[model samples]
Target: MDLDQLRTFDRIVREQSFTKAAAYLNITQATASMRIRALEQLLGVTLFQRGRTVTLTDQGMTFLPFARRIIGTVQEGREALRRVERGRIAIASLRSLVSPLITEPLLRFQQHYPGVDVVVNEGRQAQIVAMLHERDVEMGILCWPNIDPLLVDLVPLVIMRERVPLVVAPEIAARLPARPSIEEVLALVPRVISLRWWQAEPETAAALVRLAKTSVELPTGPARRLAIKGEGLGFFVNSAVADDIEAGRLVEIAPPDFEALHRDTAMVVRSLAALDRDMLADFIAEIARECAKVGIILDNRLASLGDKVA
Candidate 1:
């Protein structure tokens, strides 16, 4: 019924344990229990099933999203007030994109606006989206195809397309032809280290699964490392493996039959009117500039903004 009750319920759902949630919230276990009991009594439904591990009941599952929205709304209001009091920017980004996409722009932004506080939270796609919706972050940078502006309520400010090339250790590359067929590459090195960096073309994703003798999904960092260690061939963004390729640590394989692979990463904001317009525009320009330095192409829509802020 109250904010404390809603927060307690949300924390319990996330922690999946009353004791753990209570500890996190810095409240006694009895107080946490009492809050939940009061909430359930007011709602007239059993929210959680009593057990060693907390499990949400049907009613609890139904109410969870609403409860989270309420909590997020309150938090958002607090963040808005804080922003007004001082210059602060919070961003959520995909883990894989942090080094390749965010780092340079962030460093540049800081140099220019030393007084403004910037925070970057890295997570998977869903987690980043959640952070944006919850107003835990003002912006999000992530790969595209799953984002729907209408559905997620996040507006795309800029989108960058980067080429993803199949790379392998130099030793493995030495055994293959200049323009080998995918089957030939597979024959030479049966293992494929897959990183779902983007929503790859369905046919390409399926074909890799069908043809590779051994396929293992890994995060971008580990997959790139494994490819460098000669464990398997990996498809990595050009920026991610550029240094390695230049140093002869890895070789890019261009298969005649394989479609060119690329990933689209976008910078999105929940509401532009709610943000510091000049600051946001300046940061977007910095991102575009960094992308260009590494051969990532920005969307046509951002060209005008780039020019204005460049």
Candidate 2:
């Protein structure tokens, strides 16, 4: 009936665990159960069927969207008031990619709307998802494949794709042949600089894992630094090291039959309703405009979302 009750219901469904939902809400499990019970009683319908694993009943499925809308409506009202009183907006993205990707867009947004305060947060995919679901951030810019619909209804806007080149230190490249096989590349790069969490997709992550004998996994910033210092052979997104490769600091070590490695990025919102606001719409536009400067255009994948587009 109330916002708190609706939030508990929503989080329970998303997390699929009463214990996790309770912990996330900073409430006791018993209290969470009681709230759900009270809500079901008020509605005269059993929301979730009790079982070893909680599954939403027919009633719950029908009510889910309405509950989400209610919570989103409340959050939107708060955001509007915050704009007037605090002049603030929150955005999140990867720390390393933000500079090459969104820095120009954000700068232009600031120039045109200097009065609006923009708070930026940087983290891995899981962290970003948490922030989005909690309404801690109004927008997120990250790899498109990393967005999971169950966590949040993302309004994905693919801005660019970069080839994932296999590279080594310039000195190492000189000693190696013009092209190497997968096995040779793996053997040469004993300590491959792999990203532990921020992969383009699950299949890509699995492929990389199988290729590396001894991997040195790190987050975006540290991974780039280690790769640059020639600790070992590395595979990286082209944008992350395009300058280094151009300057001859890094060399591409391609396999004879290596497929081009392309990763796509998108601008996302928690829900389509989240994008209905003018501020968010403008921000999305700014991202597209800035990406155009770098020759990245809005992708058809985003265009296919139909009415989800703002």
Candidate 3:
């Protein structure tokens, strides 16, 4: 019936256990049970089917969306008040983009707004989206073509597209002929260290897999390292390995028959009205400037938004 009970119900649905939800909320199991019972009584319907594992009843399923909306609205109200009282900005970003895309822009933002407090959380795409929905962060930085229904209500403040190049160590590049075909490169070094950090097309991903005699899945950091060590060829966003390529640590290989690949990263927000317009504009400008330094170009109409905010 109350926010606490609704929160408890939502947490239980997420955690799939009353005991776990209680622990997460830092409340006693008995108290959690009492709140749920109170809520069920108020609603005149059994919400959850009690069992070894928590399963939502038909009525609970019907109420879940409403519960989430109420929670989100309350959270938004709290966030708006907090923003007015204190200069606080929070964002979630993909781990791979943190170093290349987020760090420099954040430093520039701090220089401009020294009194403002900034919090950055790093996670995968899905986790970042969940954080946005839960109102845990005001904005998120992630790869584009998300296709998640949850993003329908959000706005993309900035979108940057960067080329994805095939790279390998200097020594590995030396062993290959000029303008080598993908098959020719794979013949010399059959292993391909793959990182799916970008939202590549399904057919493109499958094609890359098929080309590699030994396809190894790795996180961004490790995949870059392996490619630097000449263990395998790597497909990476240009910004990620730009310094390495410039320093002669990694060399980009252009296969004549291979398709040109690009990945788009976006800065998304729940609503523009909840943000400090001037501050957000400055932050966006800083990000665009930094990305351009690494050859990542703004691919969307956010430049006009930035101008309007300015």
Scored by CA lDDT, what does every candidate get?
Answer: 0.79, 0.73, 0.82
**Looking at model 2, which ten-residue stretch has the lowest summed lDDT?**
196-205
Model 3 — TM-score against the truth? 0.82
- Across 118-219, the per-residue lDDT of candidate 2 in tens digits comes to 888988777777677667788787776664664645767655665677778877677667776777666656577766434434464457566777777776
- Off-target runs (Cα >4 Å) in candidate 1 are 7-37, 47-66, 147-151, 199-201, 295-310
Query: Which candidate leads in lDDT?
Result: 3
- Residue 300 Cα positional deviation in candidate 1, in Å, after optimal superposition: 5.0
Ranking by TM-score: 3, 1, 2
lDDT of 1 at 103: 88
How many steric clashes between backbone atoms does each model show? Answer: 0, 1, 0
Itemize residue pairs with steric clashes in candidate 1: none
TM-score for all models, in order of appearance: 0.81, 0.74, 0.82
Clashes of 2: 1
State the lDDT at 59 in candidate 1.
100
Off by over 4 Å in 3: 1-57, 275-277, 295-300, 306-308
Q: Could you give candidate 1's per-residue lDDT for residues 1-310 as a string of tens digits?
A: 9999998998898789999999988999999999999999999999999898899999999999899889888998898798789888788887866787778898899898899888889987767876776678877887775553323556677777888888888888888888989888888775888777764444675687678898998987788788888888867888888888999999998887988788787778777554345666677677767766666666644565444555
